[model samples]
Target: MENVKAVKPELEFTDYTNFEAEPIHPVEGLSQRIIAQIPGSSVATRILQFEPGTNTSPNGIQIHDFWEELYIIEGSIIDLELNEEFKAGAVACRPPGMKHGPWKSPDGCKIFEVRYYSKGQ
Candidate 1:
């Protein structure tokens, strides 16, 4: 794989807050800011935001072909399948083919996430 993201100088804390978030298609109240990405691949770093009262049940259970790492930046979200609430500071790593989610956030939430494939896809 080639370097897909452009190099940049160190960014200030406030710089991250300036990225515009775009709505995730067909999912109401859910949005993301893609900070870095590998073109034509499932490799990227992003910030996912869920507004208050947001529910992702419409997406159903998710199973991906790539690894997913997530860190909750603020607020909380409930995993509908697990019936568990994960709050800020929580982290999770899901390997390829893991089934998870359809989540809901009652008070809003933000998460920093990275998605990538292993050596052999």
Candidate 2:
């Protein structure tokens, strides 16, 4: 894996105009802003906005092939896996292949996310 250069403070989250909100795949009422990424390394940072009444699924959870860490920056969301609600200031880390989230956001939410694969993946 190539080294990812450190992101300067001033360069991060400075331009929101360029980020177009798009629907999160296989999930409804969730939009995403791909903030920054390391080319060729599968490492990405993103902002996720969940519109009110969004839910991933009612049937089952979704699992990722990469590590995912997230923080609730504004508003709140419901963790279906935990059967509870998480508000701003909440944090979560999921290891590769961890089954999680069939999530819901009754009041809407905004979260910052960082994701990457394990070494050699």
Candidate 3:
């Protein structure tokens, strides 16, 4: 068998959570942006977790004028647009100006999303 060694990332990780058990957002909701460039990561990668009854993009989602992708690392999510569903390990990409938020996951969800400003940047 071929063996592979686990290596460290170019970027370190930091926890993103609300100090309170409740969620917080505009209009009074909560979300946790766990990992990000704020922690000096290479890219603007984030571990965003939504609480039950919370919407990741509460007032309508907006994608940057660039490319963005999301991989469901844990739990489940429903894409309101096509009424399609995504589960753990499912990956989705939303291109520039895609209005794709205000979604709900009753049991909560954790997603890994990253943005690259330019090709191979």
Per-candidate clashes come to 0, 0, 6
lDDT of 3 at 52: 59
Best by lDDT: 1
Q: In model 3, where do residues sit more than 4 Å from their true spots?
A: 1-10, 13-24, 27-30, 38-43, 119-121
Q: What is the lDDT of residue 114 in candidate 1?
A: 90
- Residue 63 miss distance in model 1 (angstroms): 0.6
Tens digit of per-residue lDDT, candidate 3, span 23-111: 44562344546344423323456666766555555556555555567888888766666576678898877665667755667677778
lDDT of 1 by residue, 43-119 (tens): 87889999999999989999988889999999999999999999999999999989999999999999999987667
**lDDT for every model?**
0.87, 0.79, 0.58
Off by over 4 Å in 1: 1-14
Candidate 3 has which clashing residue pairs, if any?
A: 16-34, 23-29, 23-30, 24-29, 24-30, 25-29
- Candidate 2, residue 68: the lDDT equals 88
Q: What is the lDDT of residue 55 in candidate 1?
A: 96
Per-residue lDDT of candidate 2, residues 11-94 (tens digit): 543765488887877677888987776665557788999999988784368776778899999989887889989999999998
Top candidate on TM-score is 1
**Pairs that clash in candidate 2:** none
Q: Give the Cα error of residue 84 in candidate 3, in Å.
A: 2.2
